[model samples]
Target chain A: MNLDELYQTVILDHAQRPRNYGELPQATAFAEGNNPSCGDEVTVYVKLDANGEKIEDIKFKGAGCAISQASTSLMTVKLKGKTVAEASKFEKTFHDMMTAVTLPEYPQGFGDLQILEGVRKFPQRVKCATLGWNALKQALGGNSSHDPVTSENE
Target chain B: MINAEQLRNDFPILHQQVNGRPLVYLDNAATTQKPLSVIETLDHYYRKDNSNVHRGLHELSNRATEAYEHARRRTAQFINAASADEIVFTRGTTEGINLVANSWAFDNLKPGDEILLTEVEHHSNLVPWQLLAQRKGLKLRFVPALANGESLDLAALDSLLAPPVKLFAFVHISNTLGLINDAKQFCALAKSRGITTLIDAAQSSGHRPLDVRDLDCDFLVFSGHKMAGPTGIGILYGRAELLEKMSPWHGGGEMIAAANYESSTYKPAPHKFEAGTPNIADAIGLGAAMDYLDKIGRDNIAKHDMELAAYAYEKLSQLDFLRILGPKTNRAGLITFVMDGVHAHDVVEIANTYGVALRGGHHCNQPLMKKLGTPASARASFYLYNTKTEVDRLAEVLHKIKEYFTR
Candidate 1:
């Protein structure tokens, strides 16, 4: 019931002024994710480096709650320089954490993403924290070039 | 006069606390808290008369049959239908609408025929026709909401009632906007044009007086759960002649008079629609809910609702951060709003911390949400058992949410 745990200062700051919050004009990959229950939508656009394996640039544009927007913003920062495989691994780790089955030891480099681990206690908010990650996965997985892939919490 | 505080005692579910604070339930539009009268009715039925209706020759079957049929008669009187035969039991409003869409409209409407609806219909009232239109190659036209997003445009409605428009369906009260339309006048207009009319009265039947004979709509639908009754029970009031003319929606035992290897003949209007063994206990519980509401009186409930809505609107509007939806005048028993910087989910989360339950979402009116240009909203709906103190608490929680998010 503690509101501060869910709406941490970092979360609110990222929600208010999200980093890399714009449409990527030079994007090679794109996907849209929606939490229809709460109307949280995030569109992720990624511009991959030559060879199309490493993410050269990533940006997200959408509206959602503090947790979702903050998670998306933080995700763009953490996954920018990583290869597509690394981003997918990170997404799996984050999903496991939100689903409350993360390993005790942190993955090699969790960075600021640990702040969102508090969401594990709030079961209803797990979907909010993972919406952006799911969208990012959709962007990196194949079919990003064909149609704007859309994903839901369900 | 209905004393909400006194009536509150009758609902045992309201006495609990959530998250260490007194529970303030404002989600009445989604479903009402079942009163002890309804609960006890269900208990009594299950305890003594738990048998299949109109099937067995045992004493319990006879008792169950009598109770279920009596419940139908009570439901007919509750809505002031022309006769009990006109009231067909369905799972809920969604099923009732589907029944009509499948039985009446499927048979009556053809390719190029149009069904007139409004922009503010819930998905239940809207989606069935959308599916039917796609399947039958029927055309659908909408009467757009007025500029305020509260009332319907009568002028557009008149213009759209051109030739080949077979039926007109609309919600009596918008669950999202909390605006009550004049169903009688709307029905009269459609009736004058010789168009079949249906009113989705899921929100209105519990909060106001409903007279099917007075409204004269060809079809009316409402749910039991929204009226302090059990779930999985609702009524579909169709004109006797129209219901008789329409083919049976679902085929099964209770709906048929004689069945053979070759074919089957159905019963009269009401029985012909109710296919299988119905929700007998919940139907009896619905009767109990109606009896309870009748004692309180729907007119008084309506007044209580309006007073609560007006009070909440006046209070919540003071917050510059909030934008209220629906009519400023002559609104229904609920208020839906969105905060300037706060998402409705966040607003609901903080309100939950304060032990207040407000519905936060599209409210199954996704198209209407798009029309309002907001993805979702926080809605606080009132029932006859709600009080000004609860409204005040809601306002206080909303203020706290605004202050919490803005700070």
Candidate 2:
């Protein structure tokens, strides 16, 4: 319930002045992700390596809440050098951590996504927190129609 | 004057607190709170008359049929439609727009034909036209808003109504801006050019007194949730002739007079448009909502909302960071603004912390927000039961929220 769990310094730093918060020059993969419930949005880009195994670069360009953008910013940091397979796992972990969906790939340090766990409690902002990861999964060939409008988290 | 204390008693849910403060629900633009009359109507239907409406033989089904037909009649009266047959029960205004776009516009629109819309149109109004135009190879035209944001440029609209312009779409009031556009004058002008018109009354129906006959629109759409009714039901008022001419959007049971393998004929007007079993309970509930509104006298509700909105506008304008969007020349019950150096969501979160339930986002009008040169906005929408005291709490909490974020 305390802001401590939700606003860890790292998430705050990324959210306050987000890094790589713009579109890229030769975007590898692009997908539109939305939180239709709250109207939050995020477009994730990951320039994958030759094998599409590792992320060479990542960026986002869209308007979203702190949790969403911060989560995207954090994923952009944590996802570097991670294979598409690894990202699928990280995504599973992050998804489970955020939505309690119990997916196989859900990651640890949900506390890393902690600023957003307040989202799980609020139920409304879960979309805001997960917009980025959902977008990331879409770019990594998980699924294409990543519309958050009908997403259960929203 | 609205009976604040007495009126507040009917809404059992509004009395609760949020975060740590008394709930100040100013999101009527998004959805209005249901009154006990409407709630009771839903309960009464489910408890007693829960059956498939229309063409039923059993007593329960017959009662349901009567109540459902009675709601159609009541809604017809609510909008002053020529007949109950002209009123179609839809899911909400969004569904209504999609219905019209698919049913009417699909048949009528052609390549190079332009559908004219205004800047203040909501996504429900704007997106359907966009889809129709995209699907039919039609061009979408828009009349730009003036600097003050009070209304669209009538002269520009006149110019835009050239031969290619087949339909004109717009909102009676901007949900984000609170500008009540001059619908009669505008729609009349569009009609002179032989243009069909659709008005998104989602924001206006509950906030303003409406006379669809007087407005003379080919179609008018409003949601039940935004007008003290259940969420799943909305009313789409179309001229009987227009309704007769249009095809059905969704094809299913209950909309046809007869169904056989070789060939099937559809029913006329409202029945044709309403294809499934329909939201019978919600439709009955909507009837109850209209009855509640009639008892209230919409003029009185409009006046109450207008006064509170004006007062909220003035109070919020006193702060430099708080800038209300759109025209201030007197609107129905919406006030959108930005807090300096703060994101709208942040402001919304802080306000949530204080138990003030205002809305924050593009409010389903991202293009309008872009026109206003803002990413998103915070909106505090007023409704029937809301009072000046709640407005004061909104103002106080907004300041406290700004401080919370800035500090």
Candidate 3:
């Protein structure tokens, strides 16, 4: 229930000056994630390599709470230059970190994302933390048909 | 004068601490905490008389049926409906509105008819009509909010009330803005135009004195949970004449008069509307809530609500970075505001750590939020159990939240 645990310094920094924040004109896949409960929306756009395996570029655009914005910003930074399969694995690791019963060990390359592990203490904000990742997952799954990824479903 | 300090004793949940701080609950607009009497009533119903109503031949069944019907009568008296038959019990206000939309509007409204609604309506009041309009080839029109986003533009109502408008449905109080619209005046205008009217009294019913006859609305819906009752029970009060004419929304066991494989006849009005085995215990609990509210006097409660809201509004107005929504005067016991450069979810999360419960979202009024040009805002709604001290706690927490974020 501690506020500091949820709003860590790095999380706040990323929230204030989000990295890779905007639309991607040459996006190969795109999806919008919506938290209907709070009206928070994040549109994730991805441009894959010509071979369609690696994520060459990634961007997100939306307005939300500090957790949602910061989580998405850190996600774009982590997923860039990784293969599509690695990005999915990263998402699974992040999801496991947020949902684990006890504070699990942070693996290598976890980086700033480890700050979001505190979200598990507040079950309600877990959805806020995953709002962007849900859209990222949709984009990687080839959701260019523009179906919205709702956190409620997850 | 209503003593909120004394009233707090009746609501046991108000005495607890959250996050190592005394809980200051300001989320009453979403749902009010149930009083001891309502809780005891539910306990008593389950412990003593638990049985199906209207179909059983045993003593427990008679008792359950009596208590269930008594709840209907109490609900009728709570809103001053003409008779118990006028009150049709539904799940809550959403289901009540949907009931009217399906049973009455679908049967009466034609392809080209338009349903006029206000811009400040909660999604429950707006969406049901939208779905119905889409299905029946009907058009939906809105009475826009004024520039201040506090009240409706009554001047434009003259044009919107013209022919082809079969119904005018609106909220009695804006859940997001906290403005109490003039239900009596609105109903009168609709009556003059020969258009039926439905008032969503979900926010107004428990906070103030309501008289369906006095307001002259054709149909009014309210949730019991918002008025110190249990969830899963609400009342939809339609004029007896209208209830007699409209068909039932649900069809099942209890509503039938005579049934066979060929065809079945249905009972009249209220019973026909309540189809399956209803939430009998919660209905009884709602009856107890009505009795509790009556004993305290709704007029005194309304006065207390207004005092707290005004006090909170003035107190929060001191903050330079806060933008308060709704008019300063003549508002319900709620305040909705947005802070500079901070999302409502953040404000609410920070406030929660200080043991202040707030609703941080569009308050189910997305259309109104869109009109106000904000994605979301934080709201603190007061009730009879709330006090000036709690409002002070909320104000203090807001200051801390602002400082924490801005630092």
Best by lDDT: 3
**What is model 1's DockQ versus the real complex?**
0.77
Task: Give the B-chain TM-score of model 3.
Answer: 0.99
Compared with the true structure, the alpha-carbon lDDT of candidate 3 equals 0.91
Chain B TM-scores across candidates: 0.99, 0.98, 0.99
lDDT for each residue of candidate 1 in B267-366, tens digit (9 for 90 to 100): 9889989888889999999999999998899999999999999999999889888899999878789999998878898888889988999999899988
lDDT of 2 at A122: 59
DockQ of 2: 0.27
lDDT rank, highest first? 3, 1, 2
Fraction of true interface contacts that also occur in model 3: 0.85
User: Tens digits of per-residue lDDT for model 3 on B1-407?
Assistant: 89999999999999989999999999999999999999999999999999999889999999999999999998888889989999998899999999999999999999999999999999999999999999999999999898657778888887899889999999998888889999999999999989999999999999899999999999999999999999999989999999999997898899999999998989999899989999999999999999999999999989998899999999999999899999889989999999987889999989988999999988988878877888899999999999999999998899998888767
Q: What is the lDDT of residue B254 in candidate 1?
A: 90
| lDDT of candidates 1 onward, in order | 0.89, 0.80, 0.91
* TM-score for each predicted model, relative to the true structure: 0.97, 0.85, 0.95
Candidate by candidate, in order, the iRMS in Å equals: 1.1, 2.9, 1.1
Which residue window of length 10 is worst by lDDT in model 2 chain B? B398-407
Candidate 2 residue lDDT tens string, A1-154: 4544555566667767777888877767867777644446788878887876888888887765666677788887777677778778777777676677443332553335434555566566666777788778777774445453224344
Candidate 2 lDDT score at position A131: 76
Top DockQ: which candidate number?
A: 1
